[model samples]
Target: MESNEPLYVIPERYRKIENLHIVFWLLKDLCWVMLWRPLGLVMIVPTIGAAALITWQTRHIKSELLHNIAVFFWIIANAYWMITEFFTTDDSLRYYAVIPFSIGIVAIAYYYIGLRFAIKK
Candidate 1:
């Protein structure tokens, strides 16, 4: 039996940007791991920019919007934690990264707990 649900396809441009975002994210992390502060800090611009762009592009789709928003927050939290490690010896400040991390979690939770039920209605 054939299912009736429509296929969802991402545009090629969006897909290309998403692939590039991964490269930026990896470079950012690699820089952090190597203790290369300048490059790591620079990489934050493009990495966060790409994530913001992706979230904007997906805004029309509730599910994608929620998840991408979470991703945006996740990248911010990761970058902030990396910066803390790069600049300071105080490990406690790194805990502040939890703010963005928690936002991401709330976005996901809202989707799963709130939006999911709303969609079913």
Candidate 2:
């Protein structure tokens, strides 16, 4: 981490516990996606790597970090829904994914807006 960055540190022992929470949530979403969408297999490895990142970044950081993590999973879940719908019903449910995806985008905007304008210098 940069020495001058606004960093938060978690207790060393709690890190493992916090990471477990991240893994459980990430794997749950990924497995659900994998069950319905074959294309999800392509992301298995990358998702695990990303889960680690989510865990690390979210451990002791502000709520904004958790918001970002939620955004990622929301997008992943939407992609899974879209991919499965594409393979199963020929794009019949593709439009339904717009809801969660839109929500994810909004969450991202909020997170950034908070970071840029809400925090004091």
Q: What's the CA RMSD for each of the models?
A: 1.4, 6.8
What is the overall TM-score of model 2 with all chains considered together? 0.45
Off by over 4 Å in 1: 1-3
Per-candidate local distance difference test: 0.98, 0.59
Error of 2 at 31 (Å): 7.1
lDDT for each residue of candidate 2 in 1-121, tens digit (9 for 90 to 100): 4587766666676566556646655664665555734435554445545554664667566564657565565756555674665467666566676676676667667667765577754
Cα lDDT tens digits for candidate 1, 9-88: 99999999999999999999999999999999999999999999999999999999999999999999999999999999
TM-score of each: 0.95, 0.45
Candidate 2 ranges beyond 4 A from true positions: 1-6, 11-62, 65-69, 72-76, 79-83
